[model samples]
Target: MGRSFEDARRWMQEGTKAFLDAIGLLHGDDWDAPSGLPSWTRRHLVAHIAANADAVGNLVHWAATGEETPMYSSPEARAEGIEKGTRMSGGELLAWVRDSAEKLEAGMAGLTVDQWQTTVVTAQGRTVPATETPWMRDREIWVHLVDLATSTAFADLPEDFLEALRADVADKRGEVPEVFGTLADVTAYLAGRPYDNVALANGEPAPDLGPWL
Candidate 1:
C-alpha cells in the first residue's frame, strides 16, 4: 500500500531524531572529511539538510495560507544558503539543524487536513499536495543520513521504506529494469547509493545509475 500523511508524519518525527543522532557523532576532522557524494564534505551535507528543512517548510506555509511561495526565492539563493551554512562552526550547524527542523515540525503540526490537501510546488517544480511535504523531508532525512556514511547505511533502513524508495526511484525513471535482489540492494542500485551488504545477482554487475533523485 502507498503511504499516507500520518505515515509520513511518523517517518519525519522518528527519522529526524535518528538523523540528528547520527550527525551528532561527527567531530572536528570528521566534519571536514568527504561525504558519500564527491565534492561535498560532511559539513556541506549538514548544511544542505538544514537548508532543505526551511525549503520544505515554505511549501507548508504556502498550503496553510494559499500563498505562492516557492521553496527558494531563487536557485542562486539556495546555493548561497548552503554556502553560508558551511561557514558555521560544528555547534552552530547542529543548532541550525535542530531549529529549522523544529520550525518545520511546528508548521506541519499547525496545519489543518484541508490545508494539507491543498497544492504546492516542490523544489523541483512538481506540483503536489502539501501532504507530500512530510515524505519529502523523510526522504531527505533518511537518504542523507546514509550519505554521511557515519553510523548509518542503506542496510539500516527498514524493508518497507526501502520498497517505497525503490518504487519512487522506478517511478521517477518511468521504467526500471527487473532486478532480483534484496530490497536494500535493489533500492541502492536504483537510487545510485552504495550498500555494504550488496551482492551480485547471478554474477552480473549492476547497471550504472544516474544521480540520486
Candidate 2:
C-alpha cells in the first residue's frame, strides 16, 4: 500500500537528514565542483534544493489559509532567488537549507489525519491531495542527494521508500520519453539518470527532444 501522510512525513524527514549528511562531503574547492548534473555545481544544486523547500513551504502557507498563493512572483524571480542563495558561503548555505527544511517539517507536522486527503493544486498546476506533498518533498531530497555524487547511493535507501520511489518512477514511464526515447532507453529516468543516446530496453525511440532535469 502507498504511504500515509505521516509515513511520508517521517520518510521525508529522514531523507532530508541523510541529504544534509552528504552535504558535508562538499567543502572548500568542492563547493564549485560539478555534480553529475550538467549545468549545476554542488553549491548551485544546494541552493536549488533550499529554494524549492521554501517554495513548498509557501504552499503549506496557502493550504493553511485556503487561499491560493504563488510561491514566487515570477519564474525569473525564483531563478534570482536560487542564484542569490547559491552565492552564500557553504556554512550560510547549510543554514538556509536547514531553515527552509524546518519550515516544511513544521508545516507537515501541523496537519491532522483529515488534512492528508485535502485537495490542493501544486506550484506546477497539478491538482493533488495535500497528503501527497510529502512524496514530492521526498523526491526533491532523494534525487538531489544522488546528484551530489556522494559515495552513498539509493541502494542504501529504506526498502519502503524505494518501493515508493519505484511506483513514482513507474508512473512516469510515459513522461520520460518527453526527453529520451522511451522507458527502455532511460532505465533510471525518473531516478534522474540522463539519456546518453542509448536504446531503451523496453520502450521505443522517442520523437521529442529531451528536456533538462
Best by TM-score: 1
What is the per-residue lDDT of model 1 for residues 1-213, given as tens digits with 9 covering 90 to 100? 477678789888988999899878878888888988889998999999999999999998999999888999997988998898889999899999999999999999999979989999987889899989999998888888888878787778866677777888888887666666677777888888874443455656656767684
Q: TM-scores across all candidates?
A: 0.94, 0.80
Off by over 4 Å in 2: 175-190, 194-213
Model 2, 84-116: lDDT tens digits are 977899989988888899888898778766655
TM match of model 1 to true structure: 0.94
Worst 10 residues of 2 by lDDT: 178-187
Tell me how candidate 1 scores on lDDT: 0.85
Q: Assess each prediction's global lDDT (C-alpha) against the native.
A: 0.85, 0.72
Work out how many backbone clashes candidate 2 has: 6
